[model samples]
Target: MCALRTQFRYLNPYELHKIIINQYVLKQPEDIKLLQRNKSNDRTDYHVLVDHHRFLWEDNEPKTWEEQFAKRYFEKLFKEYCIADLSRYKENKVALRWRIEKEVVSGKGQFICGNKICNESENLRSWEVNFAYHEQGERKNALVKIRLCPSCSKKLNYHHKKREIKRLKKQSKYKKKKSDSKESGSEDETIVCDSSEPESSESRRIEADIPETSNETPWEEHKPEVIKSREEEMEDYLQDLLI
Candidate 1:
């Protein structure tokens, strides 16, 4: 189906924002691989995968019949499932099948939060924020893209934290490698930044020629003059006693 504009014109800005944020689905394993009824879902609430490629973009706007229909379909589900009655949403969608797409980008995109409560701008660093829509009996998976400022992204999307951690670790490791390379290069160049005055080569030679006190024997450290004075005192005292 083609993405459309007419069907979505009736939706106000607030509803559109909510539809954008709350309606899209994060990717799940079952979305790619078929699973048994019990294994199909890790979520207690009904969530589905969204196809990013299906939503066609014209002038950076969702302007196709299929895309618009998907938006409307997801909005309907959002109201009924997430906001309204879950039972009714599930009941209405058992046989209904359709394809819709939400806007998504992997990295380095502007983010405007579709949450009515939070309109946050995010630095696009990784592929963590996702969008999803429900498909009928068949399970499907496609990642919807979103952008939010660091704080809002973390608050709205749990995957944001994981991706952010990875990003930080990668950046730190890169910096460490760069630093190690720089240090090694400096050592190769002998770039020592000693604050003390550097000694002249002649002064260094003199210091090397001088005997190192550290190697001196303990007895050699005693003064010969002191030993001679002690010996003379002892001889004089013995001479006086004999007299």
Candidate 2:
């Protein structure tokens, strides 16, 4: 007998829930907005939907293109699926807003934790971390926010603190090493000076042992000797002959 094509038999809670929502949720058709007549052009302004829509939680401020898209997508998803109360899933109001913003900005379809290890799609919270980067040869600090599961969020905090401690320890070690090298260099210089002092003192003692002499001519070095002339020698010989 030929083997039957493989099929998925197991379903997780989320998958089951999604199936039930798809089958039971009441999806309503999109309602068309009334066309506004402009006297100048005698045409409808289609830009009203985009230009007039305001985002939630902001003082009725106009929404950006990303925000608008996100809002529409969220509403459509809710209409098609029986989504649980978003407040229960959101750790805070900020987290829900962040999730929505990320959806449209990043064009992501599912709301999942940013962590690769734990990509939980439910019960997410938003956190802001200080991210340092270099721009145009200058260091800059940016506040980067992301949604994460509770476990991943805890891990992120712990990792950040540990990294900070490690950086501080490395800085302190480098400073201590630099100070030690400087002290060693000074000691070497002092040792060299101390060694040279003995040689200088020895040279001074040798100079002191040597006797100093005043300026004198070379003939003065020998004692004076008596000299006899030829006539004096002849007279001495005559006296000897008379005797």
Candidate 3:
């Protein structure tokens, strides 16, 4: 039995763009430009120039086979690049596989998501994953990549914004509370000083007016008591004679 051989025909530029737009959900024209610009080869200028030529092309403009061939060659390269890039998406495993199986299938590729402990099989549209080649050592290099589903991506962005808002609010509240506490503490100190100032002054005046020692001696204080006793006795004798 003979092994099955599939025909691999190259795609034209317009067909390639249509496929990208239809399958990958790339709606914006700018996104296509970005994708082309990010490719390993520097064909962004050529692609943009071709797009400009196509835009200005009217029925009067002569169509040449050479131009068509160049467009097809670039289109094939662009498609291949897109397929390889999109296959790196960790979330779009099914889509990536479909794209590879349908469009371009060279070999198996692996994809890991930015999320912790997330790994998935590569798909056709998975090339949309952002990737960078990191050189670990002289000869050792690794591809660092990140991928996300639309929902997960949106949720992550929203949480990041929410955290920023919460952080700002907390800082504002802390500053306001700190200022209020400082102001209140200063006012309390001022009130305490004002209330104690008059009392402290009166205490000092009383202390200053106090005599150091008494003028009378102990014997002089006792002599007054003896004189009073003798007068009392004479008064008693007179009263007895009158009776």
Candidate 4:
């Protein structure tokens, strides 16, 4: 009996709900842009539909170029995607976009949560959480999937969402503060430039050429007066009368 690929069968609800539905992460699955230009057909674009696309055709040599390409693709998948850790796939060496790992044993089995801080080994059903982030024109994108226990799944989801919100808030605050400072600086410059009128050299020269007013008292204008004591005056009057 030929044992088929046991990878896809017996998927849990969590496994079924991955964003990219293809068993294999074929490039540009539903790209209408290529279809408009007729650059690609359905089979070529969505290589997952090709039978046993995940299996490397081990003939001595591939019959056609398509079979050869499929063989090469499956080999690459085995070498790169067939790994225990989802975090390493996002690295430059691997660069796997959308893929799933085999499920853990059905019962309560020991597995480590893939959260960075809390990698607590626990007995729970583990599922791979896949997500990606890329800005519009960004060349480098972050493709990530973390195996999570039930508790850590919730915690990590909350953590990622809250962390993103916090980062955006900080960016907003920083931008607003920077803009306000620039506006204030420009306003101050405008006030300074418009407010003060510099005194002209002609005005300064006229003021300097004018004669200054004098504050000193003239010595010729003041008269010296003689002082007489009361006793001396009375004695002098009596002596004049006697004479």
Candidate 5:
């Protein structure tokens, strides 16, 4: 492929971008030629030039195509050299899966709500926000604990669902636009937005029924009031005595 484009010294941004994108496919091994000769080191090197910035493969032999692709391929190569990030936004693929566990508070003495605005200690529960992220190509699991009162927990869950619905809708919209452009024979490579997987039926239902601008939730009207704990009353008595 590099030999075929001999007319140009190095591939233009679009040509190089396409090749990098195709490197994700594991089906075929990439055939790269070591052409450039380094006189000082007396070694032949493989070089790729983007916008006059040369990227040289220092090794004498090019590694397998899979090994060539880095975990931070988008940031390192695409964004740095090709200027793809200027016109096109790459979808962030972190924390797609989460494992949230909520447990009722037992034998607690006035636990402050983790919500910055809400300080209610009544009906407190411990919520663990567990998710995974890739740092330097290693997958790391993170667990964050937050103690929240019933009302705050409900509010958190409600807002989370709302945001999730919006995300699904935005992905669907982008996919529609991409497909439409493809059918019209004017495919826009810049619009590379798509969901990693299909959205569930429940997500579709929420997107259809829930209005993004609405501040109100369906269960808010019937939300149970948080009863004051005996520990709270005892603490209040102690404060009164201190006063």
Candidate 6:
């Protein structure tokens, strides 16, 4: 019976069928239904959906994958994912709208929290994380937005409007301060010039009070000699009268 069992092992169609079937089953599903079911069970898994889009914020309804990613979902996730430090997740790389789709198909890339502390991971389908810049001609400001997982979103309790308003206010304040400092500096220079004018005039007066011997002429010294000669002639006439 042992020899017969060993001889039949290679011919066991059942074992061969089982192996073939398992491989076929694994290869059949384009989508991982198990993961989908798991994600659906927990709201936190929804963050993976954000990876489907890439935009920071949508001005209007998103029309293209690039537009959707750049403008709509990504910004929302960033607020949720933000954590303290934000530097440890050095392996995370920024994705372009085009690259995200390729990564999703390959089942490789996932969005990570830009914040180092959070280091949260999510599927590309759930959370859209985008790094964009707001630009109008030469003016530009960096915009970072992450579509947060449900758990992260709940944890953050973010206020988008408030943050935006605060950012704008800071910019305005900085501009005003810069303008004021420039004006004050210019005014100070003018005041210094005005103050120095009087000192310069006083210095000129002090210089003038010092007698200048260089201005004396040869004729001015001879006038003293002529006066002495006239005085001598008057004394001589007085002596003759006495004689």
TM-score quality measure for candidate 3: 0.16
lDDT of 1 by residue, 1-243 (tens): 235466468789988876655544333434533434566546321232244233222354556655555455444331100101112222332111222123223111334443323444555333232234444444454433333355544444432332432333355788899999998988885566878987799998998899857866789867585445888989999999999
**lDDT against true structure, model 5:** 0.45
| Model 1: residues with Cα > 4 Å off, grouped in runs | 1-117, 122-132, 154-162, 165-243
Error of 1 at 218 (Å): 95
Model 5: weakest 10-residue lDDT segment is 80-89
Residue 61 C-alpha lDDT in model 2: 36
| Minimal lDDT window, size 10, model 3 | 159-168
**Residue-wise C-alpha lDDT for candidate 5, range 1-243, written one tens digit per residue:** 677567345779897767756764443434332433557754222332121121222243425543344222322432111100111112322122211122123212125555544456786765554444554355666544455577655654542321221113355888898888788786434667677998899999988998668888899999999889999999999999999
Scored by Cα lDDT, where does model 6 land? 0.46
Candidate 1 TM-score versus the reference: 0.22
| lDDT (Cα, 0-100) at 147 in candidate 2 | 54
Clashing pairs in 5: none
lDDT of 2 by residue, 94-169 (tens): 1112233434444332366655344477876665555554433556654445556666656556534312211133
**What's the best-to-worst order under lDDT?**
2, 4, 6, 5, 1, 3
Model number with the top lDDT: 2
Residue 22 of model 2, lDDT score: 60
Cα-lDDT of candidate 3:
0.41
**Residue-level error in angstroms, candidate 4, position 3:** 75
lDDT of each: 0.44, 0.48, 0.41, 0.47, 0.45, 0.46
RMSD value for candidate 2? 30.5
- For residue 156, give model 4's deviation from the true position in Å: 26
Model 5 regions lying over 4 Å from their true place: 1-110, 133-139, 159-243
The 10-residue segment with the lowest total lDDT in model 1: 78-87
Given candidate 6, what's the lDDT at residue 186?
A: 80
